[model samples]
Target: MSSNRLKILHWSDYACPFCVIGDKRLNEVLEECNIKDRVDFEMKAYQLDKDAPKKPHLKMEEVFAKKFGISIEGARDRVDRIAGIGRNEGLDIKFATVQFTNTFDAHRLTKYIASQGKDVEKFIDLTFKAYFSDNLNIADRNLLIDIAEKAGIDKKDASKILKGKEFSDEVRKDEEEASDKGIRSIPHYIVNGKYVISSSEKSEMKFVLEQVLKDEAEGKLNINE
Candidate 1:
């Protein structure tokens, strides 16, 4: 088998619960196989509820109910289900405390973090936990800088990037690219530049990765998405 790694471009939004769940599942599979070195994962940006109002720091349940026209109880149930999935993957998802905020700046910061070749996975996990579990407003620059520093980013540089809208264009480009590819949902995984798995269906994700590795082993350069 060739030692080539498969590249997976994952488009997701930190504000979305399902995207976080999908990310956890993908990470689990990669870790279980000891294939961290064999997989190149890039996280793109996608907004789930782009039109949500930015004020009063609505809870996840409130946001869900308002956006989907469902009752608060129904939204809570949905959050519970998603939270259950997250808990299984070692995430402490606090549905009630989740504050849905504009993630544009957060996405920009992520792009900047990737540019630094830092541990983006840890950065992303911390950002999700901060916003969804710790009730931190991700759109706030100070909060973003703190999270970035926690992810090993330089405090001064993180503050500069967050304060000045650095990497915002790159983030917008990523969103445009996702739209160009007809991606309308979060947790979209584009594997090997061909096989596109929408949402993190764990079994499907594993199968796709396995196939990519198999093809690489056979000296075949097939793009699946």
Candidate 2:
């Protein structure tokens, strides 16, 4: 007699707009499945630009153009395409105003909040909203504390966690584990420790979750579908 719960591991970066869209779509799949209590969800750390400066000195447009060798207008058009997709999912991605900074500290704070048995998704949502929608700096300590408080995390506890390296190791561990799995992209989802899905399309994610549940209920032990 064993418990039949789906364990989902998601690796993402805060600076990646695609990860933001993917998170929202994944949530929709979970909600529609009506198995909130039957699933175990975990967000892991994977920095898209681990070497990024703590405080970025360039605008997002310039950063994009320089990184991809495109004109500023071309960068805007490219990001606008992703922003259009986000709008379809009821998200506001203000790419022009977003401050792209290192997300290592943010990941550490999220790890600490999740360890307290709190709803880590709430904090993750706040992080995305603060960065993508409000264009707030996610690396700011004060801002992180405020977001934590809004997510039901104690302000004092959050402040303390930010002041020290309490969850730094946990964040690093997640990155290392993901690297061991040969994961090279963000928003990667692993279901039941076997099935792997890379796309963030809402319909695809919903179909996979439903399929996993159906397979488990049918006593299928080797779930590769």
Candidate 3:
């Protein structure tokens, strides 16, 4: 944060619907403010349910109802509400048929892509679509390899990474750091390593990021990341 640009650390899960909404809104603000080049993004991985199975065995509503002790109707309402938000953002989020599965491999693959200085955002966006829109199983190695290749990653390299334990530590480190900070939410964004911003408040998010830019230009004291 004691640097010339604004730093954005976003902690989110690929399988989270709220993350889809938040990410879309945040990117909109960045583009609208015309501050894309003045900000740096570090997309950290955080799984809501780390123990989720590699393949979903139930409908999205059924799983939510069982997990939260709610009626199937109530669970459907919950998912539908989030889907409504995604619709407002012009996204296709079919949580009703979501393939809710373990995201460890997807997160690990993202870490590997970022480490290789590849198009991390493209890969992340593509993976998000695969889960929320296509209702595809992100934990599937073949699906991951396909998504990675479409994101401009080498198909062979992605296959090798998925076949082995590569970049797992990076994903774990992100999770551990979020835990130490007592962060228990997805689509959480930290600015300057201090101020927390959420896309849930669009005006506030725009204001906060713009303020960081102004403070940086003025040489104000910044909280270092």
Which lDDT tens digits does candidate 3 get at residues 62-118? 888998999999999998998888898899999898888999999999999998899
What TM-score does model 1 achieve against the real structure? 0.89
Task: State the weakest 10-residue window (summed lDDT) of model 3.
Answer: 1-10
**Which segments of model 3 are wrong by more than 4 Å?**
1-3, 221-224
Each prediction's TM-score versus the true structure: 0.89, 0.89, 0.92
What ranges in model 2 sit over 4 Å off? 1-3, 221-225
Question: Candidate 3 at residue 39, lDDT?
Answer: 76
Per-residue lDDT of candidate 2, residues 58-146 (tens digit): 77888889889999999988878888888988889988778888898899999988888887888998898898999888889899999
**lDDT assessment of candidate 2:** 0.85
lDDT for each residue of candidate 1 in 1-225, tens digit (9 for 90 to 100)? 455677888898888877888887887877765676777889998777666544535777887798799999999998788888878878788867777778887888899999999988888988998877887778777888888888899989988887786787888788899889988888898877887778777898788767766766676865343
The C-alpha lDDT values of all candidates are 0.80, 0.85, 0.86
Q: Model 1: how large is the Cα RMSD against the reference? A: 2.3
Angstrom error of the Cα, residue 5, model 1: value is: 2.3
